[model samples]
Target: MNTVPVNFDFSVSSVEVARRLIGVTVLVNGVGGRIVETEAYDREDPASHSFAGPTSRNITMFGACGHAYVYRSYGIHWCLNFVCREEGHGAGVLIRALEPNTGIELMQKRRGMETLRLLCAGPGRLCQALGVTREHDGMRLNTAPFELLLPDQPVAEADIVAGARIGISKAVDIPWRFGLAGSRFLSRPFGRSHK
Candidate 1:
């Protein structure tokens, strides 16, 4: 796999940067996988967490780039987001799913099932499978235990699909959700355009 540049440019729009994440490898511990789905959220976007401004829970979102903005969703499952949009920019690219690459046994064990389709198929499930939680909050992606490595070649643009963001009540019309076209690992509603 080709690794992305050490100095990942984060000064661009989240939409453009989000596309760079496709086909990248996300390694946590001995487990690893290729990112297949993601959602871009900008601080100025009403549908984003930082739109309301940073607080204790979202402070990491306002920190340096490439850090993790992990948080619990619905007070139950942890979801992982990579901080983007330049330094001190409150935005992120939500990792919605992964295509299991390494440590399949570990992933299956953590998920309590053998079905590949169901494992790491959603944001919460992927985090659970990779042991990502609040403990990894603010962790830099350039280090071990948690890293995002770009491939030698990225997914072709023709193979990617963009649509409205899901699981949000606001900014419902924003076409910030992106994923590998027709990938089975994508979360539901990914194909649904903003209505």
Candidate 2:
């Protein structure tokens, strides 16, 4: 079913929708590479995490728009987001890390580990090397093959670099986390001692 091209357009330009989602490619079909290292959760500020509005596990971040909001952090990690403002507005953008490309032996046997940059880097190791659970909570990021591909060179807001958010304690200062600076598959830099 690899015909590609389904992008459920969401009226882009949220900071170019977070720097056009860097080298876009997040394949987890059979499990492997599709390098992705995202992190841009800004919704007119208020220190996001849906800025305390939609309940019931962030009601798919207010629904409609390119969805997919699997949550479950600190209770044993499982955070993968991408539901940006539109249907009702709440905003999203938190993939975190990935760079497997095409099933590195089922992502090193589901991240049992053998080092491949410790498989996926962050966001709970890219949702445990792309098995993204919590029942794929609120899926709809363009469907089939769990999609989100738009690369060809599109990550440059001066190469991005925002702060805050990482093991959050709440609002920390609201710098709106974003990355890619020296991207070794970012997500492990937190608030830099508040600069």
Candidate 3:
């Protein structure tokens, strides 16, 4: 039987929701991975796609919480975000990185690299590894082909680290980016194509 919670905490603010997601296992298709990094975005934040209100592109951000809001970045790679907060609240938490748990070969094939860390170490890379795209937008995260398996308990605050989100100019001081402390799966702060 599946041990993951069917309902994740979606009532909390984007920041809290991001913090709570660390350590949860995300399953897509036949592959699964532990979510190691995340970034929170709320309507109030200028960096959020919903900040200027929903458009045809961000419709999924206004639907249900705990749903995937996959979108392409720079027309080159797809990024994955989890819709959060109340229905219509317009909030999302980006799944910035993950630790591959299954189907490494497929992930490598999709990402075009064999390095374990690079397989799913960034928002784009993770989505590419899982074959997620705008087509998967609005898909329920607790169901098949897109599942989230919660941990027994939230990762301890001490084991978690907060930092400013990368590659964004506005709301740069919010410190909404969260990652498992010392985790190798976090999108590296330095180096090209890292953020």
Candidate 1: worst-modelled 10 consecutive residues by lDDT: 1-10
Q: Give lDDT per model, in order.
A: 0.83, 0.66, 0.84
Per-candidate count of clashing residue pairs (backbone under 3 Å) = 1, 8, 0
- Could you estimate the TM-score for every candidate? 0.92, 0.32, 0.92
Error of 2 at 47 (Å): 10
Spell out the clash pairs found in candidate 3: none
lDDT of 3 by residue, 1-195 (tens): 232384667767888889889999888887859999899999999999999998999989988887889888888989999898898889999999999988999998988999998889889899989989888899887677876777777788878888888879898877888888878877875222221
Best by lDDT: 3
lDDT accuracy of residue 82 in candidate 3: 88
**How well does candidate 3 score on lDDT at residue 126?**
93
Candidate 2 vs 3: which has more TM-score = 3
If both were scored by lDDT, which would come out higher, candidate 1 or candidate 3?
3
The TM-score that candidate 3 achieves is: 0.92
